[model samples]
Target chain A: MTWEIFNAIGTIAFAISGAIVALEEEYDILGVYVLGMVTAFGGGAIRNLLIGVPVSALWDQGLLFLMAILVITVVFLFPLRALKQWKRWGTFTDAIGLSTFAILGALYAAEMNHPLSATIIAALLTGSGGGMLRDVLAGRKPVVLREDIYGLWAMLAGLLIGVGAVNQTWGLYVLFVAIVILRMMTVHYKWRLPHRTIKQQEDVSV
Target chain B: MTWEIFNAIGTIAFAISGAIVALEEEYDILGVYVLGMVTAFGGGAIRNLLIGVPVSALWDQGLLFLMAILVITVVFLFPLRALKQWKRWGTFTDAIGLSTFAILGALYAAEMNHPLSATIIAALLTGSGGGMLRDVLAGRKPVVLREDIYGLWAMLAGLLIGVGAVNQTWGLYVLFVAIVILRMMTVHYKWRLPHRTIKQQEDVSV
Candidate 1:
């Protein structure tokens, strides 16, 4: 099914991205695999929990697990210099993964009769949760919380689906494409959410 | 009834600890409250997911939310200098929270007929998951992953409970107390998990 294909693509994409981050962070082999697996599955796990899906169900995705492992292994086996374009590849795949997963998460929640808020939350988590976990484990701030308008697009996609504005299969595909394009555009333009920072002196007093 | 009481204690303790960390990190008021709530409930949310509990069930604990908020507010109201002993207080409360939550998580998973692996995972996550999340949100490595003998006691407690070596109310209480004492002793003695670090030079080739 199309859904299965999208899921596989997202999983492979996230696993490779995670492996890259681990390598960049100079993590050992075990750490690399752990980060890769977490990045590939952490989002869906978080979303499942939010939408009342049994976390045990995660273990049922044997093929997906295998796919992620394969991707991670490939990433590790390749020389970093040979993958000089890893950054570009990572961004492209990340955009695809995020879009596909966001739509999938929203549809799953909506199908389960979750409310708009829950659906939106599910989409956001599914789209960015794994990457956030990967960054945290790498001892960095979660880019989703601080960087470009990332999670918002996922939430918007979820909102559209939850509101029944895009329920058909073709409609879902269109939405996915739109999301990916939007994400790419945002990154291209360096779009960011508004931020607030208290002065260091004032912050210390409080 | 006792379980509810223990849960409250854990919640309060974690909320306070989270608030303190947020303060130390110089995060804003919003970040402080967010971290506090995450620390108090994130673990249970994770454990529930793993054990097949509906995450929406998290919303059912209105009293817990109120308690966390109250604690965060109180923590913020106190002057930082006045709370100079916060590190000591935080460690003591964290130990209590960790032990109680670990036991509770293991018990919940065991009662659900989960396997030993799931039970132990639940226990570890319940005990340290929130703290890990808080640290990540604060942009620090998880203390549970890096510091002394923290998660081991939780795993041991879970292992005991999972194997039915300790199941009765009295047995559970004993296990909880033992974990707390062991944790405190480890901290006092500066005990740590055996660590291995590959040289940066060696890590790059792989």
Candidate 2:
């Protein structure tokens, strides 16, 4: 029951986020739905493919698909002026969705007896893969790769799971909350991942 | 034997193409290899995921991976002045890879008894999907989506296979050559798919 609830929340949040990006990019209605569905399911699909899950298994989540579609439609229909108020909420919900999906991915990989590295990879992909796809489709730089410590939170969740530190139901819940809080803190503090330009290196050599 | 040969052609050509793009974007050596690998295998991986092929099957082709890596390394080490001469050939080789992969994708889907729509989709994805992934990772618009009639040839190949119009070995070769020629002609003539900007539509409405 908890799993289903968390999944639903993540799906709805991702769908809304995708819809917002599509709107910002001025995509057509079809593009809006396409992006929304991709954002909600693309990460899981990518993870499943990598972890040897049957791709057809994706089709079984009919309810989640419907929920995502409904959420995206509502977001699309909401007044533009009113939608501006939800911008801050979008970040909060996105953080929740990211942490939830990351933990779930780690748990799933662990249950499959995958190695620790695979578990961590699964978590990172499931947590940020959808956003990467969205940014790619929208022709923007992937924020997760270039911005704050977003993927680190997912890796942390994966490490916690792989080490058997968050096995119990209460423990999983606690981990979820902790990840969300940490992600939000990074955002609040404007944390950034270190990056260096090749151009700078070339200039130094010259 | 023929199938393996075509796969090699596609993989090598794609790797070089990807490496060139990475160099153009001034990525580090690691980025070049990552992009090269993604461009070579991304389309096939995506097609496998969508068509119920076990994605782990991708790892079995150790030789192909090695070949791609070698090709990328060679391209990376080549003289930059000499590399400029191959720009025209890049288009030719890319066309070959695109057509070869598209036909192969269509045949795979048809052999699996997928519907014509799925076969066409598979072909399109397999042909252009890698390039799309490359462009997205490079933080640029996907040329496949924005320019030319690139995907049409893939769809046509899928349609031919799905309809059993090109079942013989000789017929498949003929179809492949025809697709390459058609794609080349489209490029030579600068043919473009029809597109409309939302800004133009909004301007008209106002």
Candidate 3:
């Protein structure tokens, strides 16, 4: 039950985020819908693939699909004035989505007997894969690769779960809440990961 | 025997293309190898997922992985003066890779008794999927979405194979050759699909 609720929330949150990006990119109605759906489901699909789940398993989630579509439609119909606050709210909602998905992905992999590395990879991909696809299709760099401490939290969640530190249902809930809070704090504090630059003759510039 | 040969050729071609793009993007050596491997194997991995093949199947292709890595190393080690010729021969090599992969993907899907649409999707994805992933990772727009008549040929190959018009080994070879020629001609002649533009207030410009 917790999984279902968190998954639904994540789906809606991601769909809205994707729609916002599509509109910003000047995509037409078709593009908007495509991007929205991809964002909502891309992460799960990728996670499933990584863990050996059949891609056709995605078709079984009728309710999640409906929820995502409904959310996308409502986002598109929302007033432009109300959307001015999206910058503030978007980060919060995205954090919620990322945390929920990360936990879910880690739990799923742990249940499937995947190793610790695979579980962590599943968490990171499930948390950020859709957003990366959204950015790529919109012709932008993926934020996770260069942004604040985003994927790291997902990895942490996966590690905790894989190590059996958070096994029960209540423990999962706690982990989920903790991750959301951590993600929000990271964003609010503007935490960033260290980056390295190569010092060489920059010849090819795309 | 044919499948092995075609698959190897496609892998080398795509790895080279991806390495070139990474070089052009000014990525480090690590980035070049990552992009090359993703380009060489990403599509097949995706196709396998869609057809219910275990993702672990990817790890089984040790020879292919070695081949792709070797190709990427060679591409990077090639002389700077000779690298200029990449712009000249890259298109031809990419066309060949695209055609071979498209046919191979379609044939794999059809053999699995997938629906016609799935076969077509598999073909298109297998042919262009790696390149799309490479471009996305490199932080650029996927060329298949905007390039001249690229994905259409893959779809055509899938359609023919799915419909049983190209069933025999000889027929498959003919179809593969035909697709390569068509792709080359489209590139040489600069054929492009008509694009529609939406008139809207550009809000989010990446």
State the lDDT of candidate 3 residue by residue for B46-164, as single tens digits. 77776667657889889999999998999999999999998768987788889889988898888887777667767887898888888888877667755578888998999999898
> For candidate 3, lDDT tens digit of each residue in A15-102?
8888877766655554565578778888888887778777756656767877887888777777776665677677777887898889
DockQ of all models, two decimals each = 0.14, 0.12, 0.14
Compose the digit string of candidate 1's lDDT tens values, residues B133-171. Answer: 898888887677556788888888889999999988888
TM-score (C-alpha) between model 2 and the true structure: 0.60
| Candidate 3 ranges beyond 4 A from true positions | A1-44, A47-52, A58-132, A141-206, B199-206
How large is the interface RMSD of candidate 3? 5.8
Q: List the residue pairs that clash in candidate 2.
A: none
Q: What value does the lDDT take at residue A29 in candidate 1?
A: 57
Count of steric clashes across candidates, in order: 0, 0, 0
Q: How does chain B score by TM in each prediction? A: 0.95, 0.94, 0.95
Candidate 2 regions with alpha-carbon error over 4 angstroms:
A1-53, A57-132, A141-206, B200-206
Q: Which tens-of-lDDT digit does each residue in B34-118 have in candidate 2?
A: 9999999998887787778876789999999999999999989999897898778788888988998898888888888777766
User: Model 2 reproduces what portion of true contacts?
Assistant: 0.16
